[model samples]
Target: MVMGYVSGAVVFLVGLLGGVGLGIACRQYWVEKRNRQTREQAASVIAEARKEAETIKKEAILQAKDTLFQMKAEFERESKESRKEFQNLEKRLLQKEENLDKKSEALDKRETTIGKREKLILQQEKEIGDKEKELDAIMDEQRRRLENLSGISSQEAKEMLIRMVENEARHEAALMVKKIETEARETSDKKAKNIIALAIQRYAGDYVAEKTVSVVNLPNEEMKGRIIGREGRNIRAIEASTGIDLIIDDTPEAVILSGYNPIRREVARVSLERLISDGRIHPARIEEIVEKVNLEVENSIREAGEQAAFDVGVHGIHPEIIKLLGKLKYRTSYAQNVLQHSREVAFLCGIMAAELGLNEKHAKRAGLLHDIGKAIDHEMEGPHAIIGADLAKRYGESHVIVHSIAAHHEDVPAEDILAILVQAADALSGARPGARKELLETYVRRLEDLERIASSFSGINKAYAIQAGRELRIIVESDMVSDSEVVLLSRDIAKKIESELSYPGQIKVTVIRETRAVEYAR
Candidate 1:
């Protein structure tokens, strides 16, 4: 029984193993079949997708070709149009080139014609020159024959004719000069009179004539002795301090202060009077008084300068210049106060400038500064006018003002209207009657000298000094002096007077030549 049971179990185990093998084989077969089917479906889908892709690729290729063809055709059309336009432009350019060539040819022809005309003109000019030479020769020959017939050379005849013409021209020129002078004098006199009168009427300044010396009266004669001090110490101190000389003469309680500088003299006079009144007569006292008086006088001078500028309505003067102007207050020109004279000149300048339609303020400024040099003339060299001009220039005055200052006294030529105005104003101020004074002896001597100079000239029979020695009238012998000789004689006398004498303003020299015809009746 054990054997049979083992056999049956083995068979059963065999069957079970066979069954399990069969099931695994069947499952493997099914899986293979399914895998084949899946592969076939995938293949088909891949083939269809490939065909669709090919179709899309073809369509894209066709569209690209069509676009390329259309673009090429459009480009061809545009190129054809452009080529046609270019051909038209080329034709137009060729026509313009032909026109330019024709114009060039016409210009060449015109240039040739102009060259021929120039040659003809040159030939005509040469012919004209030849004819002119021939004509000149013939005319010269005729002139020579006429000269020989007249018994005079051509040059001599020409000289005679020139002399005649010159004489006639000279006479006419003299008449014209006289006429012009008359008219000018009449107009100038009226204008000048009006202006001067207006100036004088507007200004009423008092004339103060300063003397060279100033007097200081003392309280008693004993004061002189004290002022003299021991060995003249006090007087020396006073003189040294004031730059003046104290004249302690026996003049009865008075001392004379002498100085070339009026300011110094004034200072000395004031200082001495103060010392006398205070009863202090020492060198220290003298110096102290001098310093005090100097300061006072300086203040006075500054006030005067300010007043002068105020009166003239001029401003913007430099302080240093104003100080120098103030010094003019103490200055005197021929006994005429220089400051007063400057004021008069300024007024006159203003009036004249107004009438002439010039800058009145500028004119007045120039006039006021014209004589500024007189303030320090003794300390410097050169004419006052030139010195004043230099001062003005150094102090930054305008060129016009500097020139006017220099020319006012004729030190330099009056080149500007302002200069001329200043000159005229200066003359009006200085040349008025009694405006200035000279010593009687000098005045008489000047008149005598003027007469003597006039008489010294040749052909002058008599000489007379008239118009306060401003004019010299000389009588010439009729036989000795012709009209021209009389003129020359007058000029000679004037030149001699100018060289030998010094006079103010100007001198007029007149020479008279008169012929008398007398027959005795029996």
Candidate 2:
């Protein structure tokens, strides 16, 4: 029974061992199948990923090509615009260069013409000097012959010797004067070269707009009708009161005032402005306003003159001259106010005179009064320079001042340093930037030309350019020009004007010869 039980246990142990080995084999097979399946799935996923990556790469390349094309088109468009702009700038530059070249050529020609004129002038001066020397030799010969004449007493001989010594002294004096003049001229020339720059640097002043015409501003368009007034009575009254022509036209909110006299025009402007402001539209009111404005203007003129003199450190001017100087406040040449120009000229003269060791006060005085005649030049006939000189002489200004005034414009030769100094100062003042208006100057020159042409004929005492250069009236000397000759003179003047002047419209020429006998009661 023990053998049978041991065999059964070994059998049981073998059976259990077989079962365990079979299960182990089965588990190993299952694990291998799962690993194979996972490998296959991973391979399929890698293939699909590679296909998607290739599609993305192709799309990116196509997008990059499209972007490059757009960039190229944009660059080409910008380059074309840049080229067009450069071409336009090049054309403008070329045109400007051509204009500059033309201007340069014109300047060179003018310079050559001036050089030729200078050479001719120098030649004429030398000839005149030689003639003067010959005259001097002839006079010396005649004097020697007079000295050797026969019938002579001791006293007479002594007198002749005295005369000889006097003549010798005069000659030496002339030589000394010439030497001094030469030195002075050299010094003055050197001073002049630097003086303009220095004076401009040291002095500066404001300028005024040239008021050739006056216009009154109105509060509204309705004021225009009021200015014209009932049946134009107010307009006529204002014109009669102010001696100015008033035009009420299509211009809105403004009334045009026309007159040649700056003072009269200023008065008219002020009066009209006052009337407009006060809302008084009547003939009686117009006259009252005008008269009041006139007196105020006069007082203002006097005050301006006094103020100018005080500012320039000049004194003792005649009262009448002061009034005339004050009148300069309303005077304008080009765009430069006459009073302002005078002040600037005075300041410049003082500075230059100080630099040259001259009387600064005298120079300033002369410069201040240099253009004084312009204040009333419209009322007088003659060059403003000559008129100013006459007025200066009449008003007890020194002979130096009078001469300087006359010579400043070369109406007479500048015979002294003071006169020359005034000329330089006047030129400097006038030449300052923004001092003049070319158009106004041109108009003035035309009027001047009209008078100058009439005066060029002999025996004409005075010439007046009236009606804005449309008419020229000439006053001939009674003794020099007859009635028939006056007609001929007028014809001659008309023909000369036509030939010499470039003008529009017809210019009427009238010549009058009148005799005046003056008697002053003692």
Local distance difference test, candidate 1: 0.85
lDDT of 2 by residue, 1-522 (tens): 999999999999899898899889898999999899999999989989999999999999999999999999999999999999999999999999999999999999999999999999999999999999999999888767776675565578899999999998998798658656766786678568645533332222221222446778888998888888889888999989998888788898888887667788899999999998899889989989998999999999899999999999999999998999998887666557889999998998899999999999999999999998877666677778899999999989999999999999788998889898899889877764446665456668889999999989999999999986789999999998988898888988987986687664478998988878899999
Local lDDT at 363 for model 1: 97
lDDT against the true structure, per candidate, is 0.85, 0.85
Off by over 4 Å in 1: 1-210, 438-522
Model 2 lowest lDDT segment of ten: 201-210
User: Could you tell me every candidate's TM-score relative to the true structure?
Assistant: 0.47, 0.44
Scored by Cα lDDT, where does model 2 land?
0.85
lDDT of 1 at 299: 91
Error of 2 at 235 (Å): 0.5
